[model samples]
Target: MGQESLQAFQHQVGDVLLRHRSFLDVSSKYQESNGRVNRAITKAVTECGCLRIEAGCQPFEEAIALSEMKNRFDTHLTGHLCDHCLDTVKEELGKNLFYMTALCNLLDIKVEEVIEKESKKLSTLGIFNLR
Candidate 1:
């Protein structure tokens, strides 16, 4: 799509989301054009509070559970365009952010710093398997 057209489309999506901003704190609300955080946001919506995450699940485990649930939701949504209900977007998004932000705060790490470090490591390893 043309840049202007894309911008307009994004604006409309934002408008739709803004209309119901209170219902869910979805990824679309916080994501830039980049797809990374958007994935997290979509995940938050799909997770809908029952991430099957045990209380004992570590951060990595929690992240994985959230991602898996998100992938399932993507598959299901792709097959159909059913309307959204009480999807745990808010809870999942809140928790996803809370855990990582908290971890970073405790570790004295900025997200940018972490990303840069990992990017360098991946470059050194000559791998880009960032799934």
Candidate 2:
């Protein structure tokens, strides 16, 4: 609700993302696009998160497996995934959710809060208005 909180959250998210994606921290230089790094983290979180939710995988492994699976898929795909693309296009929403969580963590927010807020906005304003 507060601008300061939002800004703080954004900063934390940026820091985490940069640290995770920074070429300096990486060994192989992945040769992937910025999109891939984003996607990797996102898919790892979502798919892995889901798996954990269903008791299919542990919280830690869920994300890691998703990243690994995505990499494999990306590598096997037609284009040279080895080129080190960001892989963002493969899972746009996945990346978005990661950023969202990063912001939530920064702002000390709960996913339930965001869901409720958006639900109220949608019901009152309508999706077309994006209100």
User: Against the true structure, what is every candidate's RMSD?
Assistant: 13.4, 16.4
Question: Against the hidden reference, what TM-scores do the models get?
Answer: 0.30, 0.31
lDDT of 1 by residue, 34-81 (tens): 344455445544554322222343233445554355343322232221
Model 2 lDDT at residue 77: 22
How far is 10's C-alpha from truth in model 2 (Å)? 15
Evaluate candidate 2 by giving its C-alpha RMSD to the native, one decimal: 16.4
Cα-lDDT of candidate 2: 0.48
Per-candidate clashes come to 3, 12
lDDT of each: 0.43, 0.48
lDDT of 2 by residue, 14-86 (tens): 5666555533333223323345656554454455432111223323344554435533332212322221233
